[model samples]
Target: MTLPGLLSATVAEAIELVGDVRAVRRTLETLVDLGLGYLTLGEDTPALSGGEAQRLKLAGQMGRTQRDAVFVFDEPSVGLHPLDVRTLVHVLDRLVDNGATVLVIEHDLDLIANADWVIDMGPGGGAAGGRLVARGTPEQIAADDDSLTGGHLRRHLGG
Candidate 1:
């Protein structure tokens, strides 16, 4: 069992520290769902990869009761396998369903495909890439002619 999972399972009743046991368990489940089931609470923070840290930060937000808030993520899919991307998207979707506005700066086609609205920037990278190249639903962006992102997105969707 994961360190957090073990703690929640074995010493939950004794902890009685803050929040309800159910809330703590829910948080643990969210961590496991984000592909962090193998992590131990005592694990060294510096040992985690960038993607693991990002997902761990996201896990902290999953159980919050906040609504109508805006959450921003930058390349949250960095180290995720293709299969794991779906879980990340699901978590983002849950945030939206709970009335949060999620703005993800992501290059992952699968994650972008799940978005309700997309704003694609970058006619080029570096000093040449700050312009808004496209803004619309995934299908609309895929169909746009002037957007470079559109061209790639079209192929990504098998269009």
Candidate 2:
């Protein structure tokens, strides 16, 4: 016997049915981070965008207790606002502090600036790229004339 209606309830509706208020609240926060706050549990998983799916996976990983792990992310800031980027950075920073190695492939200067280390790639993209242009802290990257990323970072930082 199955309660199809109950099983198909929206996230908001299902949260109402959960006994643990804190857990529901935490789940809501995670959903918000994934930009899925507007979604209902009734929404099919296949309807999610690639970024949404990635974030959902990241959210699940965030709850795990993993040490000495390597986490890689691609453009996590793709759909996030500046404030949301800050939140995402905070989470990544926490993971790093907790002994996880986070390697993010991003073009967002804000995220780059907050990183402990950066490996700037490419003298150019596509057929002209795959070279390591620079590697250092944000300050060093910003000062490296060989790095296009550094030029942009320098401008962004008003250096």
* lDDT string, candidate 1, 23-57, tens digits: 76677677767867656655677988877888888
Q: For each of the candidates, give the backbone clash count.
A: 0, 1
Q: Write the per-residue lDDT of candidate 2 for residues 1-159, one digit (tens) a residue.
A: 135774576555665565477976678667665555556666777987665667777877766775988988888787777787787788788788888999999999999999899999899899888989999999999999999999999998999
> How many clashes (backbone atoms < 3 Å, residues ≥3 apart in a chain or on different chains) does model 2 have?
1
**Poorly placed runs, candidate 2 (over 4 Å):** 1-20, 33-38
The candidate 1 region of ten consecutive residues with least summed lDDT is 9-18
TM-score of 2: 0.81
